[model samples]
Target: MRAADEQDYLDFATARVGALYRSASLLTTGDPHLAEDLVQETLGRMYVHWRHVSVADNPAAYAHTVLVRVFLSHRRRRSSAEQPTGALPEGVATEEDATLRLTLLDALARLGPRDRAVLVLRYWEDRSVEETARALRSSAGAVRTQSSRALGRLRSILGDSLPDLTRS
Candidate 1:
């Protein structure tokens, strides 16, 4: 690749790495190690396609899509069977209640990979149904259906504790 292209890719990666890592963390249900791995894999893939990606109308969106796809692909691997523990891991700080966050992440961890992906993309990433559909390589109708079902499952998993957990 040309120097200018390499520089552009470096700039883009530097700008977007934090956001990508955040998204990957959510997708991995707060597993920082796996999240870091996912973000690295996403950036590596993006670097390979940076020439085309940098010129896309929405490069950030493309990066997000790549992150989600990489996450889903990782989930499909045979070694993806390990589950997160109920308690949240230490060292990550947030203003939000840690109990609430841990509760939510625990619920998310119980979900199937596609269901978790749908919820994360639709609500966490705040993407449109069509955008999420494109990212997941599914129809908008499927996205909507999966989102609805996933949310219901989350609610079921959380049970009545959700309201209490969210209470300030």
Candidate 2:
């Protein structure tokens, strides 16, 4: 790559890495280690495709799409079957409102990978149905259906305690 192109890629990665990590964290159900790995893989892939990706209309969105796809691919691995634990692992920092965050993340961890992906992309990232569909390589109709179903499942998983947890 030319010096200018390499510089652009570096700048782009620096600007977007934090956002990518945040989305990856959500996708991994707050697993920081896995989230870091996902972001690294996503960035590595983006680096490889920077020449093509740099001219895209929204490179940040492209990065996010890559992060989600990397997450889904990771989930599909046979060795990825191990479930995350309910408690945040030791040394992980928590926000001031840790209980509420933990409750929500724990609920998210219970969901299937695709459902989690839909919810994260549709709501957390605030992507439109079409945008999320493109990211997931799914149809818009499927995205809508999955979004509805996933929200319902999240509600079911949270039950009435969501209100109580948030009230604290």
Candidate 3:
């Protein structure tokens, strides 16, 4: 690649890495290590296609789509099973905030992969139904249906605990 192209790719990656990590973390249900790996894989894939992607109308959206696809692909692999842990590692949050975060992540982790993807893309990333459909290769109707079901599942998972958990 030319120097200018390389510079553009570097600048784009630098600007977007944090957002990518945030999305990945949510998709992975707060697993930082897996989130980092997903981000790295997404960035590497983006770098390979920089010439095509850099000039897209919405490169950040493309990056997010790539991250989600990478995450789903990883989950589909045979070796992707996650082992359970009895305790969470230390995090940089107040006790109450940590509890809330853990509660939410636990609920998210229990969701099916496509349901989780719909929630993250629709709610967390704030994408339109059309946009999410395009990213996930589903029809807009499917996206809407999945999103509604996913939110209902999340509500069921949180149940009455949500009110108590959020009390500050």
Candidate 4:
């Protein structure tokens, strides 16, 4: 790659890496190591296709789509069934906030990858149904159905604890 092109890619990667990592973290459901690996792979792929990606309408959005695809692909691999266990270390949040966050992440972890992906894209990333359909390579109806079902599953998993957690 030319120096100018390399610089452009670098600039873009630097700006977008944090957001990609955040999305990856949620997709991985608090697995920081796996999230980091996902982001690295996403960035690596973006680098390989930077020529095409840079000129796209929205490179950041493209990068997020790549991240979600990478996550889903990783989940499809047989070896990915081996998940590491442990809670994410606490951040600067208050204890109540930490508890709520962990409860949500734990509930999210119990979901299937596609369900989790739909929830993250629709609710967390605030993507439109059409955008999520494109990201997940599914129809809008499928995305809508998945989103509704995923929320139902999440509510079931959270059960009564969610309201109690929020209140306390």
Quote model 4's TM-score: 0.92
lDDT of 3 by residue, 57-161 (tens): 999999999999998888888375654544453458888778888898899889987889999999999999999999999999999999999999999999976
Per-residue alpha-carbon lDDT of candidate 1 for residues 1-168, written as tens digits (9 for 90 to 100): 789999999999999998998888788888888888999999999989988998899999899899988888888784748575443555756646677778888888888888888888898789999999999999999999999998898888888766554565
lDDT of 2 at 153: 85
Q: What is the per-residue lDDT of model 4 for residues 75-143, given as tens digits with 9 covering 90 to 100? A: 888455637569594358988778888998899988888899999899888999999999999999999
Off by over 4 Å in 2: 85-96, 163-168
Whole-model lDDT values for every prediction: 0.85, 0.86, 0.88, 0.89
Worst 10 residues of 1 by lDDT: 82-91
- Model 2 earns a TM-score of 0.88
TM-score for each model: 0.89, 0.88, 0.90, 0.92
Question: Who is ahead in lDDT, 2 or 4?
Answer: 4
Candidate 3 deviant stretches above 4 angstroms: 79-82, 85-91, 163-168
Which pairs clash in model 2?
none
Give the CA lDDT, 0 to 100, for residue 151 in model 1.
89
Scored against the true structure, residue 118 in model 3 reaches a CA lDDT of 93
- Give the distance in Å from residue 54's predicted Cα in candidate 4 to where it truly belongs: 0.3
